[model samples]
Target: MPIPIELSLHRHSRVLEIAYEDGTRFKLPCEYLRVYSPSADVQGHSPDERVLQVGKEQVGIDKIEPIGHYAVCLHFDDEHNTGIYSWEYLYRLGNEYEARWNAYLDELKQAGHVRKTLDA
Candidate 1:
């Protein structure tokens, strides 16, 4: 599995920058990470039970706790700190960001939740 060489959180931008040993990097929005958390609280035990996170567009990371050599636990400012994001999962999230994000938007639309656009 590809491992991250560095992780940087930009609070002002609400983005997490991940640099992998494979020379690939991903700038993941805090909202995106929060919504797609790997914890059972977010992902659930089964695919059909997955929870759809909304109104997290302004969420930011408060802390990142390392879990040995395998993963890190993210503490979101919204008090979500259950997800243990492994290196492999993080890499996949980065690689599949476009598709996943679009899917999330579609889900929100289907649920009649309109996402508020943040000012740049």
Candidate 2:
């Protein structure tokens, strides 16, 4: 797995910037991270138990906390703070961003859920 040498959260843009030791850089969006969180609350313990996160279009990260040398815990403004995003998982998320994001949107559409708007 590529190790992250730097991580920055751009609040205005709502993106997490990560630079890996191998020179791979990714600007992951907060909504993507929140919807794809690796926490049990989101992922659950099994595929059947997984819950689809909805209405987080404008979610933002409040803080990031490193967990040992492996992962970082993201504290979101929506009170979700359990996901420990490892470098490998983060890398995968970045690499497969478009596909995952599109799939998520499709899932939401099929479920009759819409992203939260300011007026919502």
Candidate 3:
């Protein structure tokens, strides 16, 4: 069964609080969700063809518009509004976050991009 998500924004953490019809909960960081958007505009058709999105350290979702009942169209502060976030995609992203995030970090390091280490 397909799950429907009721998403709410956590302004302080810059996270999207997601609750599925099956009672699963996900607190998806805006940056993580942004980078993993499944839209063709972001994912493209091939893995190597993916574009690197940089300068999103301070990016946040400014608004989320409902697209029928299947997805939510997010508008980011950086003006990236092409990705339509469906619930299935969001769930998959959440599930794969750890591996994907690590890979992203490795890719950034390989590309000579620096992610500042936090004091925390």
> TM-score of every model?
0.98, 0.94, 0.88
Across residues 1-116, which tens digit of lDDT does each residue of candidate 1 receive?
88899999999999999999989999999999999999999999999999999999889999999999999999999999999999999999999999999999999999999999
lDDT of 2 by residue, 35-84 (tens): 99999999999988879998788899999999999999999999999999
CA RMSD (A), model 2? 1.6
The top-ranked prediction according to TM-score is 1
**Local accuracy of candidate 3 as per-residue lDDT tens digits, 17-77:** 8888888887888877777777677788898778766556566899999888778898887
Segments in model 3 whose C-alpha atoms lie over 4 Å from true places: 117-120
TM-score of candidate 2 to 2 decimals: 0.94
Q: Rank the candidate models, highest lDDT first.
A: 1, 2, 3
Model 1 ranges with Cα > 4 A deviation: none
**Candidates 1 and 2 compared by lDDT, better number:** 1
Query: lDDT values of the candidates?
Result: 0.96, 0.94, 0.78
Q: List the residue pairs that clash in candidate 1.
A: none
**In model 3, which range of ten residues has the least summed lDDT?**
111-120
